[model samples]
Target: MKPGALTPQDAMARAVAFFEHLEPAHLAALDLIYAPDARFKDPFNEVQGLRAIGAVFEHMFATLDAPHFVVTGRVLQGSTCFLTWDFCFQMRRFKRGQQQVVRGASQLVFDEAGRIALHRDYWDAAEELYEKLPLLGGLMRWLKRRARS
Candidate 1:
């Protein structure tokens, strides 16, 4: 089927599949999944354009070890789709050998061409990631404890 023929859910599924084993070479083909003007945002970065979006993934590959995403749930409404996923990876420098998992969700909006126009990821960096580190984890955990009733 043509790209434009895909429903929003199909497009979201394709993106999910593509990210499961994301590699640097996949960045070059992002245009097939994302529109040229696509805007993407997550806890650490916010960028526009497919090239910039590709840069984020490139940086991810450079800074992490075997980073990948597994979609766990999907909900579709009109031209928008929400996907709950588990982001798995190992820190390249810190705690270098253990696998880490961050639970999160993404909101995606598809353009007329069925390419993703907006992709925003939602997750708590402190809770899902920072608290998993060795040094920062202690401080973050202490902070969390102090804030609780």
Candidate 2:
């Protein structure tokens, strides 16, 4: 497939489908969604290829409970599809630890095959995640309130 021939709507749909399959542990389907040499970037990891991509998901699933992606909105132009997504899940740093829910969005660029070539996420790590953790949440919230005033 050629990049020029791919429609934005089609690309968006494919991207959504990929996320839909991601829920409830569908590691096997990753190969179908990501290209062999695809590159993925997030706050914590910079990975290349399907194997590395799969490892990212694997780490998430291992650490987080009920991890899922909710597609809130999508915009497509040329080969780039900007997706507003909420990745919500309960995560704990260790067993018997308190769980926290984290949310974020990603802007993705697709190739001719509708596979993601570049995925960049946008969200405030301090506000959305770190601020919500147990001990850190209290300190972060206090800082935020002080800053606002």
Report residue 117 deviation for candidate 2 (angstroms).
0.6
lDDT of 2 by residue, 63-118 (tens): 78767787888777777777777776766564334544456678788777777788
Which candidate number maximizes TM-score?
A: 1
Q: Which stretches of candidate 1 lie over 4 Å from their true place?
A: 1-4
Give lDDT: candidate 1, residue 53. Answer: 95
Range of the 10 consecutive residues with the lowest summed lDDT in candidate 2: 93-102
TM-score of each: 0.94, 0.83
List all candidate RMSDs to the true structure: 1.8, 3.1
Per-residue accuracy of model 1 over 1-149 as CA lDDT, tens digit each: 45446777778778788878688887889999999999999999999998899889989899999898998999989889899999999998888889999999999998877789999999999999999988999999999999995
Candidate 2 segments whose C-alpha is farther than 4 A from its true place: 1-6, 93-101
Residue 143, candidate 2: alpha-carbon lDDT: 94
What shift in Å separates residue 137 of candidate 1 from its native position after superposition? 1.3
